[model samples]
Target: MGCRQSKQKSKDSLAGAKKTGSIGNGGAAEAEFSVISAASKTCEKLGVSSKQIFGLRQSWKGIKRNMEDTGVEMFLRLFKSNSELKNMFHEFKDLTSEDDLRANEALENHATLVMTTLDDAITHIDNYDYVSEVLRKTGASHVRFEGFKSDNFLNIRDPFLEAVKITLGDRYTDNMESIYKVAITFILQTMVEGMEDALKNKAT
Candidate 1:
C-alpha cells in the first residue's frame, strides 16, 4: 500500500508540472496573439485592409523605423545645442554600470511599467490626468531622479506624437485620439527617464 501511494504521488507531481508548463506556454501564445490582433485592428481602422496588415510586416517595420528616426532627430535637437545635455547624452550612450544585474532588473521593471501604462492609456481615453500620472511615475521610476520638470517632457512630446500620427494615420482618428497621444507620451517619457538614469550612473 505504501509503495502504491508513493507511485501515485510521483505521478501526480509529474502531471502538475506538465500542467504548469502547458499553462505557461498557452499564456505566452495568448499574449503574442493579442499583440497581433491589436496591430491588425489598428491597421483595419486605418483603412489598410485585413489581408494587407497580415501579409506585409513591412508596413509595421517602416512605422517603427520612422518612429526611431523621428526620435533620434528629436533627441538631437533637445541635446545638441546644450553642452550639459550633450555630455549627459554621451554618458548615457556609453554607460556600463558596475551593478549590471540590478541595472538590468531596473530596466525590465521600467519597461513593464511603461508598456502597461501605455496600454492603459489607450484603454482609458477619458482619464487624461490618471494617464499622465502613470506616465510621470513611469518616468520617475526609470530615471531614479526627483523633480522631472514639464519642460523636459515637452522637448520630446511633439516629435513623438508626430511620429505616432504619421505612422497610425487614420487609426489615431478612429480610436480615441487621446489614446495614441498618451501612449506616445508615456513611451518618450520612459525613454528619456531611463537615459537620464544611465547618464547619472555613468557620471558617478
Candidate 2:
C-alpha cells in the first residue's frame, strides 16, 4: 500500500512538472522539450524531473563563473540570518562585523569548500545513490564539529538559493528558481538524513 501510494505521488509530481514548461514556443519549445526528454531518461529520483536537472546544471554555469563571490554571499546571508551559526566555525567565531567577515580568508575558504561540495553534487546529479552517500559522508564528517546539527544542514537552503539568484542575475527566471529550490531541498534533506544516521550510530 505504501509503495503504491509513493508511486502515485511520483506520477502526480511528474505531471505537475509539465505545467512549468509552458513558457516558450516554436524553436524554444522544441529545444526545451529536447532537454527535458533527455533529462527525463537520465534523472528520476527524489521527485526531481529532467527539466529541473537541466535547469540546475545550466544555471550552475553562471554560479561557477563567480564561485567565490557567490559562496561568500551565501555565507554572509546565512550568518546574517543566524548569527550564532558563525560560532560553529572556529575561524569565524571571533568575527562580528560584516566587513570583517567578508575580508576574512578563512570564511572565504570555507565558503569555497561549501560551494565546491554543491558543485560535486551537481556533477553527479544523475547518480542519486552515489550523491546521497557522498553527502552522507560529508554530514558524518561534520560530527567532529562540537556544535554542528542536522538542522544546520537544512538551514543552508535559503541562503544558498539567494546566492544562486544573485549569481544568475537576469537568467534567474521563475522556472529556474523553482528548479533550484527542488535541487537544494533534495541536497539538504539527503545531508540531514546522513547526519542523523551518523549521530544515531555515534550514540550507540
Candidate 3:
C-alpha cells in the first residue's frame, strides 16, 4: 500500500510538470534561473542581435592589450572629458586631484584588476547563467560606495572606447566599437539590475 501511494504521487507530479511545460522538480537552480537577468531580457527587448555579441567576442580575442596601460589611458580620458565628474568620488574633492592622477603603482593594480574582471566576464559571456551572480554581486557592492551614480557607467563608455582605439590604433574599426558597446551595455544593465535589487532590499 505504501509503495503504491508513493508511485502514484510521483506520477502526479510528473503529469503536472508536463502540463505546465516544466520538466524538473522545484529547486534553487530553477528558481535562480527563472529570475531572468535584466541584461538578457533587455537585449531581447532592445533587439540587440546575436551578431553583435558574437562579433564583439571574436574581435576582442584578436585585439592586443597592455591591460594596465589601457586601463590607465581609459581613466585619463575619462577625467579629461569631464573633470567635474571627479567630485563625485568625494564629498568635495577638487578637479586638480582627479586631473593630477597618473598611472602609478596603485593605478596599475587597479587597471589590472579591471582588465582581469572584464576578461573573465567576456570569457563567460556565452554562459551568462554562470556570470550573472558575480556581476550582480559587483553591482550590489558598487551601491555600497560613498558616492556613486548609474550614469558613471554610461559616462565611462566613451573613455573606454577611446582607450581601446588608442591601444588598437589601425586595428580599431566601427565593427569593433559596436562590439565593445554591446559588451559594455550588457555589463551596465546587469550591474544596474543588481544595484536596484540591493536598494530595494534596503528600503524594505
Winning candidate number (lDDT): 2
Clashes by residue pair, model 1: none
RMSD per prediction, one decimal? 15.4, 11.1, 11.4
- Estimate the TM-score for candidate 3: 0.65
lDDT of 3 by residue, 146-184 (tens): 667655656667887888888877777887777677776
- The C-alpha stretches of model 3 lying farther than 4 A from their native spots are 1-54, 62-64, 88-100
Best TM-score among the predictions, by candidate number: 2
lDDT of 1: 0.44
Tens digit of lDDT per residue, candidate 1, span 91-163? 3534344344224444334334433444454443223344445555555554544444434654655654554
RMSD (CA, Å), candidate 2 to true, equals 11.1
The full ranking of all candidates by TM-score, starting with the best, is: 2, 3, 1
Clashing pairs in 2: none
Clashing pairs in 3: none
- Summed backbone clashes in each candidate are 0, 0, 0
TM-score per candidate, chains pooled: 0.33, 0.77, 0.65
Go through the candidates in order and give each one's C-alpha lDDT. Answer: 0.44, 0.76, 0.63
lDDT of 2 by residue, 15-99 (tens): 5555666334464445444444434433556565655665677678888889999999999999889888988788878888989
